[model samples]
Target chain A: MNYVLENIPERALKPREKGLTMVMDKGLSLREVEDVLETSGDYIDIVKLGWATSYVYPKLEEKIKIYKDAGISVYFGGTLFEAFVVRNQFDDYRRVLDKFGLELAEVSDGSLEMPHDIKCQYIRQLSEQVTVLSEVGSKDAEKIIPPYKWIQLMTDELSAGAWKVIGEARESGNVGLFRSSGEVRTGLVDEILTQIPYEKIIWEAPQKAQQVWFIKLMGSNVNLGNIAPNEVIPLETIRLGLRGDTFDHFLNNEWK
Target chain B: MNYVLENIPERALKPREKGLTMVMDKGLSLREVEDVLETSGDYIDIVKLGWATSYVYPKLEEKIKIYKDAGISVYFGGTLFEAFVVRNQFDDYRRVLDKFGLELAEVSDGSLEMPHDIKCQYIRQLSEQVTVLSEVGSKDAEKIIPPYKWIQLMTDELSAGAWKVIGEARESGNVGLFRSSGEVRTGLVDEILTQIPYEKIIWEAPQKAQQVWFIKLMGSNVNLGNIAPNEVIPLETIRLGLRGDTFDHFLNNEWK
Candidate 1:
């Protein structure tokens, strides 16, 4: 791809392990998906059908096919999984994934409290058939999980056949690794990084400042998720220091 | 439109004087435009080509025609107007607007200073042939305008033939009517409302929380602008008290 500025920062190409961007599509039309992929598909790695929205979204199969055709993995939000699991439809959930030809599944109990062992078992079981992305941390801002507990759950989930353990910040960026005000829990994130490999964790950063923070903290290759559709291009600009927030981040050689 | 819940507050239909939703388009493809109109066109009154994006945007005339055909008014952002005015190209700007068959215009001095009288003169002249949206308050967060002055400018602009004076919270919601933290300046907003008619002003509420504040304070009919393309449906829900934030706002007998 021709860039206006040369060598801003090289992002790992498609099928990349790091610098991954996962967009949260609440409900986009077939035309909308086509529009995004046609312009910014190279930057997007996956599209998460946000929070049980797929159950009601029109043309679900066609949308998934489009994303897959564009080489972007597509998965339902973990809330759908929880909804199914809560109703004892584990087999039905698998059937749903199979029906859609999905190979990536998100295992999250953010809204509901499931036993950690049971959560890991689901992770272990699902990872056998599809890539498992187990999410850690509660969805509620009031239900605080200690930093060490966050580390423990993440480590356990990763060990339990998960491909990548996502740190839950929700789509709103309130709760989990972030404060209700959308401020990053820097100390908590810093502590988690000490125990987990950065590439193995996809930070759910839906806000621009959060994206800027993650990019600045972990460089251009930080994996970010829950991004809005229109923001994919803007986020790429931030990742490569094409935006003002990261303009001097790569330019200064003091740390480089 | 079939809503999930019946009897939600009815928003004014198209050609609405209030409850106006203005989306900001920062260059979207044709397919994306179709997606927006198909899903939430009824909620959108105008689409602003953000900043100077229209200056370099592809198929600019085509995009405007599509939006117009969807019953949505289209206008260039105030930044573009300022850009042309700074270069003494007001006549050229008018020629461009006429060439595009745009019936709406935004007159703003947010990025740079222009004498209020001169600004009003421009508004008076532009309002003769087309609808004018004059923006009040500076774009710079540090350049704070006092509550009384904000009231004064808005009042004068409306009198000078602006159809609606926009409170410049910006697309980021971090300036003009708000603090850098995206918190509304309550005293300022309250002071402005004391003099200016609420329906005569379109509050630039790009954030959900900001939209909620406006909806609760001014009811569902409050004119809101700078909404992202995907947010039109979400914003409409908030207006109709479908969302949690304003769920009880319209239900209360005292509020009704």
Candidate 2:
């Protein structure tokens, strides 16, 4: 960034809508959060307290405050929502969100089974209080939702007041949206994109190869989520074709 | 660490003769280094600025100071040594170590072809300048060294004055000591231990499953290298058998 390079694709600025980068905070210490903010805060849009780590991560409020103070949105991972919902504590979950002063919430059934209508209802209800990001895939590798089901679920969630539909791949990037071998379900993604706008979805791409695949497919401004804190700079480089993987992808790209 | 847990194996404290944890710093900002030291300093014995990253990583002096201040030894990655040696800048490399106030150095032939005797001679020279950690193995996954050869190399490196001989896995944990799939070459490791003392060899096990494999095989006191910055806590938990992977391994472990 200190030196300008020709042929580098333009990346969307912070507060990005289409080229959003949502990072996964898997129990980072306060100092670590400070370091992340200092180093890669501008590149990051949202920070998800990955899975149920927020439930056990000490100083959750402080960590969230760090992100929020940096003008970055912070939300608990979708699994926490399911954890509360499965325990019949939806109200408590809302109150917990309020307690954390969060302006965003995730609705997901990645780890639990819920009726589609009920899932939509929860999305609609949370949308009133905070921006909702409803995840549309199951975490179980054995449970493969077809492309049609994915499109239907994403469309329904968006209609249910969800701001964005998250494509689940878990933190490992090896389930939902990706095969167990970490290969992208190319056909399923291509099918889902037919119905769901790329801007209304955040693909969980924790691996560099997957990030490259998505960038090649969706250009520099694709919405990506579940990125590790350390990878923000590397991902930005990939997006702008500064890294080897996408160095040639953006030479003549006009996807800014 | 805040609370005592039953069935936890006794882990050797720092300044330890064994149970060494060598972390890999692949271009962390100075603030990030502070966070790592604050969070996992006690568990980390040495940190390698991963694979020539120190060449481009800004504020190299300050970053090393942070680790040194925390009573932890820091060394440039073995690949950097290969880079310097290949360029015939061996003396310049030695000067750089002194300039950075590094008390440790690594000698490795992972990235290039070097006669075993010549590699040992470099190790002998570096051993006089600083504590040398000579790595043995090919970075090329296809260049397989038999189990006996692994032992021979490791034994010769240790004999040549390396404080510890590191088994190559190249951060990805998919070469050298491990298979391309990141599985430990159990037979190779078993063979190596037959001739080389496990205490003198630092197995590069960066992956969790690989870490679990080593912990189970060598008990809680295995010397592990190339650990990611964030995995230090998880690795410590595995060593203590507090994590699920080795929860039962050390529950009745007599080796601890």
Candidate 3:
């Protein structure tokens, strides 16, 4: 924001309860994390070590420290949670979170099947230890969960003590909230909005088009997740109506 | 690369003539450039400051110096050349190259309509100042060039003084050498290869599938361009058959 632009959207500041942007860290080296924090840390609220990548990323503890030191909450992707639960090592998963000094955890069953009650129980259990972000939706592109089920799952998870329910789109933005072609399931989102408050859900939208769709539908303060590190600045521009896609979105009627 | 693996493709070292990996730097900060170099510099041979981004980027010279110090060649994207030529700033463009102490330059008409003779003359002019890499193909997805035309342009450009001719696919890998859907024009590529030397062409393959296609087609030593900074290590794995996509491509017949 070098030049002050008229009709820019009002954006929430740091420690934001809303308009949170969660970035996905697949396998960034230590220096890459430092660079991301230095460049786009202000726009990011959370960093998700995507899926089981944290399990194999060599500098996992150091990476978490970098994010935490920057006052950004770091969490493991839900698939990592599923990885632990399916291996019957939920206790170990908790220990791993403690070992990494992570204050946030994501409980998701996208890769595996878990009974809803049991899922709620895991959310409840994880919430007791850390702020839980329970994800709802199957990673399987073929398995399209109905909007009603999405609302139900989100509500139950929130009731089960989760801080926010994450709508799964993976890192590709090609499942869950989006169709295989990366198109948003408008009807599903509309139906879910009837039950789940937009502020209470962080939609995983990795693609630029999906981000634009969310920003337009939910306004500038929408919570978004699974953002690539390189896209934080671009996403912020879109949110502030600085970029071409949203340039007219926040303009005054008189200007139009 | 930390552990030795049997049947891994022997990748050419830096200052390589072929098997070059030309990364696309789309407005990376100085720190980001350092991070990329520290993490994946060994796998990269050149870095292209993606399309006219060099003009808008704040720390262009510092970023280039970092890449140069890391023993990797750096050049402006071909679009920048067109930007200069279209604005009749060809002389200024050459001065900018000298101002930045750039040893490499790209001559391309991807976004503009330039006569073949005029394009070659620009290539010849730039070649005297720096090692020139002339790109062949249109940025428009609707504009499809036949194989013979591609072959003719590449041959003429090489004769004019291009060190290598680059096949355009843009950063999205959805134009020029590839279809709108990001699928490679296999027939066109095969026909072009029949007349053009494979070693003298750098295919702009920003997608994993396209990289895999080239690596499989040309063994492990094919030159590739427009690779994202993060994809360097992943591309190296693909080249070495360490990744699942090409795991069998380089393995011993007995092992298979």
Candidate 4:
């Protein structure tokens, strides 16, 4: 693509396996979806319906179609899955995904204390027909799991037929991999990266500063998730070093 | 209007003088405007085309028309006013507003150091034609003005016939009325409220915490500005104490 400026950091094209941008759709109208797609559709990879919000949003099928037709993968938020599993209605939940003709799904136990093996069983079961993105880590900021435990769970989830394992930061970016104040836990992140492939874990970075930190550490191709809808273009700019925050780092790179 | 739940802490009906919500629009297309108005039009009082972004935004007139049709007033951001003033194109700026059929305009010296008398003169001049919302305080957070100076400028600007004097926090909630970290300058805000009516000043509160602080301190009817477009519904929830942040504070008030 011929952009106005030259020497911009390269961005991964659609159908990309890396530099993924997963936006959390709390709830948006069909027209809103069209507008977003018209503007920044190319930059988006997956659009996850946030939490159990999909259950309350109107016109779920039409909205899902709007996203899928744009080549963006659509999935129910893991909270919605947990909500179903807690009620012992996993079959009913599968039927709902079928009703929407969804090809992607998320399996998570962020809101529940399900056994690790049981969670992996669900991931393995769903992987037969859909692309499963299983999330590791608790949603509660106080529920700090050891870094080794996070690595172990993620490794098992990936081996259990999961397409990618998501690091749970919640939509606020203030839990799991981050502190209650939304600051990323440096040692925990560093430890996880040592054992896991960076390309396989999508970091939930819902804030600008958090996005900057990840991009600076892993460059433009790092997979990031839990992005708010309106921030897509801004995040893409940050990725390409168009914004002032990351301008000097890329422009002054000694080895271009 | 009919709502899912009644007894929402009474929101001041629009065309209202207080409890005003001014959202910052940083170049959204017309369809996006329609979707937002369809979902949360009643919650918005005014839409400020953010910074000088309008200069580059396509279909500005159509977007402005959409906003006005929704009964939400439209004004070029104060940065645009400063842009025109710096280039000595205030007449051209007036012409642009007239051509757009705008009834509201912003007068600000946040970017340039125009004499206070001259800034007030623009307010006085524009007030004869359009309702002026003059902004006080510099956009640079480090250029701190003493509390007494903040009070004097706000009071003088209001007397000069500004419909409302905007406390200049910019859209980031990191300058003017706030510290670099988005913390409110408590003494300055308190002193300003002492001299100027809370209803006559719109505090630029772009962050959720800032919105909470204003609502909890000034009560629900405090006018707020520089709110993000997507945040309109959330802000209304905050205003009505529907959200957890301020639920107990207003719900348990004796008035309810």
How many residue pairs clash per model? 1, 0, 0, 0
Clash pairs detected, candidate 4: none
Could you tell me the lDDT of residue A157 within candidate 1? 94
Query: Model 1 off-target regions past 4 Å?
Result: A1-23, A32-47, A51-167, A172-174, A180-256, B1-3, B6-10, B29-32, B38-40, B83-92, B233-256
Ranking the candidates on lDDT from highest down gives 1, 2, 3, 4
User: Residue A81 CA error for candidate 1 (Å)?
Assistant: 11
The residue pairs in collision within model 2 are none
Give residue B34's error in model 4 in angstroms.
Answer: 5.0
Among the numbered candidates, top lDDT falls to 1
lDDT of 2 at A9: 65
Residue lDDT tens for model 4, B21-131: 999886576787888898889889999877655554546777888988888899977766765565566787888888889899999877666788998999999998899
Chain B TM-score for each model?
0.95, 0.96, 0.97, 0.95
Write candidate 2's Cα lDDT for B1-256 as tens digits: 6887676678888798799999988668887787788899899999987765565344677788888999999998776676566556678888888888889999987766788999999999999999999998887779999998888888888889999889989767898988888988999999888888889989899899999999899899999998999999989988888888987776665585
Ranking by TM-score: 1, 4, 2, 3
Scored by lDDT, model 2 comes in at: 0.85
The model with the greater lDDT, 2 or 4, is 2
- Residues A94-121, candidate 2, lDDT per residue (tens digit)? 9999998999999999998899999999
What are the fnat scores of the candidates, in the order listed?
0.05, 0.05, 0.07, 0.04
Q: After superposition, how far is residue A159 of candidate 2 from its true place, in Å?
A: 6.6
For model 2, the DockQ equals 0.07
